[model samples]
Target: IAKIYTDKDASLDALKGKKIAVLGYGNQGRAWALNLRDSGLDVTVGLERQGKSWEKATKDGFTPVKTDEAVRNAEVIIFLVPDMIQRTIWLEKVKPNMKKGADLVFAHGFNIHFRMIEPPADSDVYMVAPKGPGDTVRDYYVAGGGVPVLVAAYQNVSGKAMEKALAVAKGIGATRSGALESSFKEETETDLVGEQTILVGGIMELMRASFETLVEMGYQPEVAYFETINEVKMIVDIIHSKGLSGMLRAVSDTAKYGGMTVGKKVINEDVRKRIREAAERVRDGQFASEWVEEYNRGMPTVVNGLKEVDNSLEQKVANELRDLIERGKPKK
Candidate 1:
């Protein structure tokens, strides 16, 4: 069984009296900064001054400061910036200013696990990754609950990095739900594999293929949209709240029978091979290196691909369906 920690298993004492700096004000950064503050921790948002994030953070009641300044003053520094830019930021900004004996944290293990951002030997390194989107993280916290989190330690100069990581998890309300202990290697590898498979690439391809197949078979565009895309959320909600078996049981007998019999046929050995290849690329750092290079080159491939998809017939159908749904919503 997985070793899970709840609120009862964690304490905020480890993080007490430490000044925390949340670098970057993007999705995870904003949510974590607010949640930590609400949990009674002294939190400061660190970002580039005069940027939109600085203004937004200030409006949210935080005195946003420069990244280096924040690092200099903070005892616990959370690197919540984009993974692609972390090496540059850490080498030029954070590493030079961070105080000795402080703790360095991350919401993802990508940079650390890949050796992109190596901290000093004196500082502790750990991660507290909420296993959900930033909006859900904040929403659950506001509802007096929390999304699950994965905590891991890479270095433990103080011999209490795990305790501090768990405390950070608790402060963000993750312990209200549950937290599982993990390692940087495990988290990074699994996260990348999932993203490249079921979560992102597989889901997108499946939905698009389903929609195209329906449309090619003379189904109406709106009907195809409803069948292939719109109902995914409902199915996913069932699977998420209960489980796959629950979802199968909840659906019609026809659906249950059809899905069980044909699912493997659709995603058989060939598909599994491709998924393993993708995972291998991620595990070997090929994907990470290529992605960083693409990012550094202004994401030309990504932008062009997105442009093509934006112009696709499926996107057109999706846009119309979205507008129709919006127009039909009851007035507030």
Candidate 2:
């Protein structure tokens, strides 16, 4: 059986007297640092000396220091930086400065799973990944709730890696909801596949295609935006609160029928085949290799793709519609 942990299952005692270094003041880093601090854990923000994050961290009441300095001082190092540069940072700063027997924590499994950032045998390596975005992580914590997290231990040199992982999850408030055990490979592969298929790439293409079809069929841009783009959140909200079948029952019968039928048509067997292919690429590391090459080349394809997408008529219309809605809103 999968080990699912709650706040009662994980105790903060495992983390007592441990000074935490949160390396990266980006959204996730900031959220984790604040949440851990609020949990009565000692936390420090680590950043590049000259970066904008230093100022942001300082403004948030943290005495942000250089990455090496923070790593040298802390017993637990939570690496929250972008994955592309993790190996570099690990080699040049983290590994050299970190103390023997200290814990190395990650929010994602990418670097460790791919063997890009190998820590020494003296360290404990683990992950405690919150399932939601950073904004919601902090927002929910402040509201006395928390997002779920996935916990995993890649190396247990300290013999208490699982305990430390669970402790960190509790410290960040994730155990207030739940923490599920996952392997590094499983988490990394599933996360990549989900983003490339349904979450980011597929949804964007679906919205754009639907909006274009409506506009081409002589619908007003405003109406097309409302149908294809604006109402997506409302539908997704219902799906989130309830399940897929519950969402269908809550809608009009005509809508439910059309959605049930047409959704299959839109995401047909051919798309399913492609989705399998995409997942295969991720599982075999082809996607990760390609992304690394893209990042190394300064993301030329991504830059051009973003420019093309942003310049599309759908985006232009969507911008205007969004502005109109904003203007129509009542002041608080």
Candidate 1: which stretches are off by over 4 Å? 326-332
lDDT of each: 0.91, 0.91
Candidate 2: tens digits of C-alpha lDDT, residues 1-332? 88899998999998987899999978899899899999999999988766788877888899998999999989999999998999999999988888888899999999999999988888899999889998889899998988999999999987899999999999888999999999888889989999999899999999989999998999998889888988898899889989898788889999988988998998999999999999999999999999999999999999999999899988888788887878866797
| Candidate 2 deviant stretches above 4 angstroms | 326-332
Reference-based lDDT, residue 64, model 2: 90
TM-score of each: 0.97, 0.96
What is the C-alpha RMSD, rounded to one decimal, of candidate 1? 1.6
Clash totals in order: 0, 0
